[model samples]
Target: MSDTLRIVLIVASVLCLLFMLRKISQSKVRIDDAIFWIVGAFVLVIISIFPQIPSWCCDLLGIQTPVNFLFLFMIFILLVKLFYMTIRVSQLESKVKELSQRYALDHMDDEVKQDEK
Candidate 1:
């Protein structure tokens, strides 16, 4: 790779790692999401420094080309992140719905008790 390209890649990778670390440390991030981001950042840094490893991995996996391996790895990690986010969103939605339902039920009960009095 050209020196400029390599430098750009390195900078971008580091930035991504920093972002992941920040997210992981934040209270807004769930444990599972933080873990996923951390693992993704780890993989990115690993693959970026050891380009040959991707080729070797491709060979072991019976993939046709080194670039294919890189692409596959990236795509796989992205999909994992997507799935994690989907699950997290689902959980949050469920919690919100449950809380709303509970609030409504309690309020209705309170109104009924007042009406009885």
Candidate 2:
């Protein structure tokens, strides 16, 4: 319930959401994957915002009672995953663009040949 814990959770949730949105906007995710990630993000936000949830989890896991550590750990993980996802999306986009350009060039050559005939 400290200010730092609250801030950490908020920042992590925001970063995860923004990352996901960016990928989706870039056409990285299909409809089903988008839905799944959206739901997962929502769940993460809910868990981060509710301190009691972490407290309960700690109790169940027989871990320490400090939710701050949990928040920090979760944020770190989310950031790493975001970075990985962004890199993958960028690579896929590049591949798609490259393939599309190659196909268009081939089609254009075929059209030119037909015209010459």
lDDT of each: 0.75, 0.76
lDDT of 2 by residue, 1-117 (tens): 566766776777678778888987899877666765666667667765787877787777777764654766568777987998899999999999999999999999999999999
lDDT of 1 by residue, 1-117 (tens): 234544665777778768877876776667765665566666666666777787789879999876677678778878887897799899999999999999999999999999999
For model 2, state the Cα shift of residue 11 in Å: 1.9
Steric clash pairs (candidate 1): none
Candidate 2 residue 15 Cα shift, in angstroms, is 2.4
Clashes of each: 0, 0
- Model 2's alpha-carbon lDDT is 0.76
Candidate 1, residue 107: CA error in Å? 1.1
- Among these predictions, the greatest lDDT belongs to 2
lDDT of 1 at 37: 56
Where does model 2 exceed 4 Å of error?
66-117
